[model samples]
Target: MAMRKAKVQEQVVQAVARSNPGDRLVATVHGISGPAPQLTMAFGFIMLFVVKYYFVTVTERAVVVHRAAKFTGRPGDVVFNLPREQAHGIASEVRHGRQWNSFRLLFPGAAKPTRINVAAPWANDLGRLLSALGAAAPASG
Candidate 1:
């Protein structure tokens, strides 16, 4: 099972790499006309597709959480499949939680939550995707 998961992850990373050969080679859009408009348009188009297609999956001993944040992945979307593990004390603020606005108590840890956005535009789509996956498993624990 782990090998299959790793293979799937590797394929995704390879696909992303192939799609974007140069990470920082974006063309400028403010100065020219015609083709320049296309450049700016391309940025939005590519980013949208990346957000829609990319997914992040994290698996622990008991449960697995999958997030599709793209470049803006949040930990909340991470579904907690197992509850035996304490909800706090981990490095993940979204998973463990943390303080917010110096008022809201999240996880009760001092360290700020690390943000690992997968880059999705909307959280709803991600939720629906997870729901479908969950239905298939129907979590035993």
Candidate 2:
């Protein structure tokens, strides 16, 4: 199972590289649905086709968010472009009532950070991405 997951991550990295040439891939993760009840009001059947994606790629100068449809001629979006001399941070929080985890990119002078919800399996990838962001952030006294 671990090997399979690694293979999938590698594929995502490759895809990101192909989509955005010249950008380094720091980490990649498979998208999972948020912690929400699968059942709907109309019927007891679960909604299995949720369009949740968290394809994050952290590069040297910016953090890119590749949509699930990037392969279909769609361009990857830049979540945050690092400044030359500005401090940045990544934060994670778990909402008790919603029972979901949120990872955010805290940029310098930004009122609201860019946030994404991820399930448990993708938490490790989020942590690695956060570490990369921290490494790339500007030093502060």
TM-score of each: 0.20, 0.51
Instruction: Report the Cα lDDT for residue 135, model 2.
Output: 38
Best by TM-score: 2
Q: Compared with the true structure, what per-residue lDDT tens digits does model 2 show for residues 64-131? A: 55555412323245434443234344444423223334555454456875555554555666557666
Q: Whose lDDT is greatest here?
A: 2
What is the per-residue lDDT of model 1 for residues 24-138, given as tens digits with 9 covering 90 to 100? 2111000111122234357865545432222332122222233333333222232223221442232221211111100111122335533233212223332332333231211
lDDT of each: 0.27, 0.49
